[model samples]
Target: MRSGKSKRVSGTGSGSRKGSGRGRRPGKTAGTSHHAAYNAGVAEGTSLNQSGGGRLSGHEAKLQMNERWTRRCMAKGASAGTAGKRIQESRAFAAGFAAALGQPDSAWQPVQLTRSAAAVVFAGPDANPASIRQLLRLPLEEIIVVQEGASEAQFAELKALPEIKILNPGEPLGADVWRAVGARVTRADIVLFADAAQLIEAEKLAQLLGAVQAGADVALVSYASRLGPFREWDDLMRVRAFVNWTLGRKELGVSSIGLLPHVWARSAMDAVGVKMLAVPPLAHVTAIQQRLRVQACPIAKRTANESGKSYQGLPPQASRKLTNESLQTVFGDHIEALRAAMKLKGARLAMPDNSRCRSAAGGAE
Candidate 1:
């Protein structure tokens, strides 16, 4: 019973397994700062080392290699942990990956320009200083924090930073509308939008930015894990799935621009118009119809700490009363999106439109 071998578990899309029951909110489980810096450095070093051997950009190429390696190890029955350890060892062959890991963040300062990006975060009721600190660490040229009835001391840290720009509108801008506001303010090639109140991580945000850099027009944090089994999903989940499915993107599952921290390419925003960003569902649908590259990027090391929290798993207990207004707003937006899609692709959405002889009933043709 003592074989000196490891068992690997390949995860092309981690936390998406049908009955796995690990529906954690995405973004919180990002590796710590030191780990993040090291991984980023390794990714960058690998990209540099490749020197354009294949069609894939360094990021995509490295991602593919990792998936392949994981799959190979799993085929031979290696544990996920073992595969991970081995992968860390194998990355040495990626040329400078080993050296990059050893180097400090200061050592790689010269090449940080490539990560230039921007963010629009709404500090809702859940705002906190820690989350704001995380946002500042990204390579964003500016972080536009929209304060929703927050006090002066509420976002002191945001104002303290030279890169932070606080926007205080006399009247409230609806939930996702701030995305449009931020998009209008920034000239960055890549932009991120999120509710600053969320307990998200800087490294995860950076990953979304990196995806745009690697050529995805819209990079969504995979939220499939948050939506338990398909059979037990609620109307919200159904709507999300239907939206992606109706647009010939069933593979995206329940990922939507309406939820989670998502990033977009400036070109994609330009194509759809910044105003479209106000209605996230509509913007997402329009982008897909226009053939823009959208991806539901799988989050690595996702944390399930929010297990008892509402909406990420089993139905909220009786104590957690559903907010009717929020529900109506989201559903209304979904209707508007579907209506817009119907206008472009007929009411049936990608399904065949039968050519009927209406003239048979009337006296035309």
Candidate 2:
């Protein structure tokens, strides 16, 4: 009886030890282990970029490391899920660091367009079916269509296109919201952004891609516009240009780079915090503030009047609010101060004449 009891006790003890060891292995490896490495990478990258003023270069370095980390993990027989989680943690770190620095993720390395390339087409409810078809036909590895407000027919048409992936946010989240969504969903070297109404051609996409390949952090489509019937639209550009001038970027003016048919490095957008809104003006402001290399590729000649279908392609109130917001963001708090100062100066300069002094001097009193 004593011998049988001892055997049972020993067996139970051994099983408990084995189970405890198994649980500790995963806890140490998956939680504490990877976390330490990820934090180290973030701290090192953030410090290096901040010190050297090499934000863009630092971004490229982090991206390369992420790719390598994923590859090594996969080669070592790690599951795809494990590899992806590690990569995502590193990416999230980089993104947060970039935002804290008030800059876009600028890449010093030439973009590798072949392996990681995609497009995000932000289509409105009135998107033409033919245009959607044209966009899908582009020679892109992956295409994501974010439909803001679509009819059942529109959803059906988009769904039928096997080459494209569709995202319906159920309601209109604004252009910037959709743009950011597109950026997040795509893991491409260069992410092409376009509006459904923009009538972007395959060749145009190639041109934008070419600009990105040549080291432009973001490439925009530029066209000339004159002040006339579309006074409001012209005023928007004027405000943008004025803000740029105030920033001492006198040679730069607001352009269509944010309008659509634009391409940006994925790393750059990711670092910029992929926000709920990223208008063309805001995009320009961010790239400029980050000191990113921005290139403008001129489009085929066309009247500015022929460019937009609706007035500025936005509802009147939305147009006003977004325009104001973009201008305020670009100019900063100093703009309000400047306006107040001007008002004070004007009041002083236009002070009412001293009527009593005039009467006394003329001996009228």
Candidate 3:
């Protein structure tokens, strides 16, 4: 028999974990002007309340408003919901335009003076010498190839390209590759690290350098498939890449999408202390901890067909596994690491949208 008196529940069980619902909150609504305004504020680093007659100047207010709006759209996209998805996609479209405007006009004096950049490639004995030669052609002050005993034939082929240096580790593959690169990059302003199998498109290096001049300490290239052979695989890889990119932009406050023709400012790398590339493929967390301003630039025909059927060549599955492993590696200790980095760098880890980029441009060098 059941008792007539109802038993009292001890706790109100904390409301569903934040961001568990489908509807808007009291102040946050989708597609509304206020929502847009709030996002603009967030992006510009000012509060709505401070816009009208507060400490922020007119330019500051405008910048803040734009940034807030852009971030709102990005945040909405990163969140789960129909409205959120729409906001995210819309903002992404807008971001393209913002990126263009973000660049200073040719008439404007360059805000930052760019120094020579170095290209560092990590190759194995089986690496494609022809592809490596093609990469060496990119406009860079120097190119260094770190190989596990690069054959004399390969060295001779690479030597044909002026300003290219070949370094043999004569050791096992791993951290030593990165050390070789770090040592060779003493005089360079930036270092680009890519695999031997990857092929970079024209103007890719220039675009990366442009991003650095625009204030991004580290710029990575986004690639589209060259051959139709791996369209399905490439598509899948893109989805995963986008997801990872979105996560880093929204949740982690970092950029992690795109292929690894990673271009980094020498100062930034020195600040982080040069180390081997032991981190997983998606080095989002690692970069964040290093206080780097990472950006992703889309490139045409940046194709990398993994050599043979080896794990490196595998597409989406391999990417997913590597991403997971990266997350796990930093799950516990790295949270603090990221927080410290953010504080030190005063970094804001969010995907920049058109409005935000525009706002950034107003102050961009």
Candidate 4:
């Protein structure tokens, strides 16, 4: 989802400038030889495919579809043993061809460019002034803070800051609406959305901005720990990640583990309507549907001690339930698309190796 626009110049009256975890660090350098690099890239792609890092390639995808069909055949009374043999044969053929051909180098390469970025923080009641001040030090052109139903007293502190734009939206526009409003007013080449208390270090911002410059439509921050209290990633997050890669929207195989302090290219945001809720599942779904290049970069995870009052506002239990419900509401209509795309990976998306092993054992007569 890389765009071909010149870097946006910084707006007037900025005080100064500045320079710019966890999930498996992106694969090391792909070595010198084109063949070797290509193979390495393919291996990374395969790893990503299995791990749900991105989408499966065509040959692999066909094989996945065939496997699903074979499962259906077994479900309808075909011999399980024969169906299993066909699955193995297809995989063998796929392995031989994939090893020889490898994936395109462009698939692994990160889009690179130099551009200015803007940070849009959704300032809730528990917004952290210190975190906001820290974020301001990054080499961004502007900062826009969205607060729903903010009073004059609430506006006083944020408005006092130079180069900051405060959007009250007058009425409470709920989570996604106000964020969308704030993004509409953001005028930088790259737009980042983080919570008021989310701690996004300067180093992380540089990596994210680099991805956007490199032509990624959206650059996400993937933390080392599980994003929420859920035992697994939310169902919609998993489905979106799979669909994005399976449909070939993004090449750099970053996991859609979580979206926080995420950065987006203005064009990409506009391409897929910007919905800036406290949580933006729909924003990601639209990006995938539009085939935008979405990459996930890893950052050191934030700790409970670090989160403080922000976590307290929406207590973990309520937060978890609401998050699940919101994502469900956002994605309910798109379940069929999710189901079809998920078949490319199947239960692999839901089960870890151990669970698969246990289930396999339990199935034995």
Candidate 5:
């Protein structure tokens, strides 16, 4: 069922025409005083333009430009929303089909392995490794921490954990981290690309593994933001996420955003290529997620605060830009590619209910 939100109107319409001289012939008898006054007003400064026949004034032109921009933004937003809805519907159909096929929910069994899953933690210079160590109590087979501008001492401190590997990039952190996570790690069934400050739940690792066993390629974990009460940043993030999830599912035939603390299969990670992350993390992840049938698994609440500190030494503006780029990469032309691939493969694409996915799959308690 479609959500009750009103369908947004596309912003496309003709601009207002300037006053016409043909309407007022030179020899025409001006009938009424009101008409004369109107003409006078047009001749005076009230009207946009008088000398150029039907040209608009600078202010009028500016107004038109603003209107056009406004319309474009609205149209873009509407288009995104429509795409998202389509994905949701497709998922629903797929889920119903699966149910009808009598596909047992617990048919797939989890891999019985004694080794712990490897988690790749991408941390900033200022992240408190202590907090991360305390939060994530998973029996990690290997913990690879990628830090930028961190001292050897700090790296050593983080590597105090058993079976931990610390890599400090003297220069800017690049695809090396992604490559390590994608290629280097051998025993890793699940890879958790996370920040140091992000507090992952104790059971998050197990839950992620469960989802993977259930046939999910990528699984995203949900957490609450513990930053300020509510801000524009939060709203924008929500909108971005909603749009990403909707469009990714519908147009790209993949699941995109929901929450952080993401977990994914090692095989799928290798397939998408590590270089993809360096280009656009979100988009790359989305492409891989769709390609691999990414799923979501609810976990602990995520708290983001000023104390959490920044990563990659990137300014706030740069971070935002990176995120936007990632979104564009995932949903841009990639969606069309995914659709084409789906058609070629004769894959049955379904749109599941976003509400149900959000609730049951992952996000919040």
Candidate 6:
């Protein structure tokens, strides 16, 4: 029999978030609460990420921990195991996965990608297909692998699989270009873009997929760590912030479709037009103009994969270097977005009109 105090502690395992204490020795409080919660019949959500000494070993370690938690949750109560939610991607992406980990045996089941869903993965020359083993578990309708500068023999394992299509552009193409190509060909209502070299954990990926399945037009993996005081931000963050501000999406901060591990709805791609996807900032601006639902998932920065070494042919590099050399490259992309917006809605674009049309009163004309 669990006492009421101990039952309250179980909130950590059940995703209640009510028992966290910040009083003297916050670490002690959290540790005691986590242990007490586990003894009360459910594992804490933090267990998925916390390991020996609060360190992350890798994705494989987390998967093994999650599997154990699944079995234990089922043994406790089959009814509670089916608990799930369909909120916006932010909560749905974090709490949905964490809470479901305590209830269901099949954590991936709640986040199923429909037959109308597809995945576009761009593999570099040094990318290993084996890293995506868990992603193969999702019941996505189709998966298009766009490999760059890699031989057919490199992906032999996934080559013979049904529903898997590989495209070789004969030369190395950037990730955004691959995303544009995938958008042009895939005919699903929901689409996922991925890099073959990224070793994202299955749960983290599922939460992002879950968000899109819950009706988001775009599901971006939130790199919240990138945000802080404005004074400390780098040029990339500054450029993203500036573009987002001009687009009347100041609330978006640095989040953008240009970042990888994002999901999109086919309608969004069509609204922006397939060609615009090659320029993600413009595509994002177009989506906003089209009134699409763009959301950021709330997976913590700790969930980020920190172990992988950068591969030579990976194309995210092109995006990283686009403007770090000088602000000119980034300004070019933003200029195009502003130009596209003005073409549709006049010089004001979508920004609010606070002042009267001073341009109309100009006597110089």
- Compare the candidates by TM-score and give the number of the best one: 1
* TM-scores of all predicted structures: 0.63, 0.50, 0.45, 0.50, 0.44, 0.60
Candidate 6 wrongly placed segments (more than 4 Å):
1-115, 151-163, 172-175, 300-331, 348-357, 360-365
What lDDT tens digits, residue by residue, belong to model 3 across residues 34-73?
A: 4443234223332233333233322222233234433554
**Where does model 4 exceed 4 Å of error?**
1-113, 149-153, 224-258, 275-279, 300-365
Taken over the whole model, the C-alpha lDDT of each candidate is 0.57, 0.48, 0.42, 0.48, 0.40, 0.54
Q: Write the per-residue lDDT of candidate 1 for residues 109-213, one digit (tens) a residue.
A: 111124346678887555776666666444355577877767767756556644467787768887577778867777777778877666565545655765676
- Quote the lDDT for 240 in model 4: 51
3 or 4, which is superior by lDDT?
A: 4
Task: Decide which is better by lDDT, 2 or 4.
Answer: 2
lDDT per residue as tens, model 4, 1-365: 23443232232221121101011112243123323323333453354445542344332332232333334434555432211223223223223223323322111111122355677777766566665665543445557788755556766876766456677766667545655776767667887776675544443454566567667788765432344544565565555545555555443232441345667888887776555333355455556656677776544333112112112111111112246666666465345555544555453333345535556577411
- Which candidate tops lDDT? 1
Return the TM-score for candidate 6, rounded to 2 decimals: 0.60
lDDT value for candidate 2?
Answer: 0.48
Residue-level lDDT of model 5, residues 16-109, one tens digit each, is 2443322322123433432442243233322323333124322233222223322432444422111122222222222222122222120111
Better of 1 and 4 by TM-score: 1
Taking all chains together, the TM-score of candidate 4 against the true structure is 0.50
Judged by whole-model lDDT over C-alpha atoms, candidate 1 comes out at 0.57
Q: For candidate 2, lDDT tens digit of each residue in 209-250?
A: 656765777776554333334455555466655655544454
Off by over 4 Å in 2: 1-115, 225-233, 276-280, 300-365
Candidate 5 positional error at 175, Å: 8.2
lDDT tens per residue, model 6, 123-212 = 776666754554543435557788777756776755754346788788766536888887666776778887777755554566677677
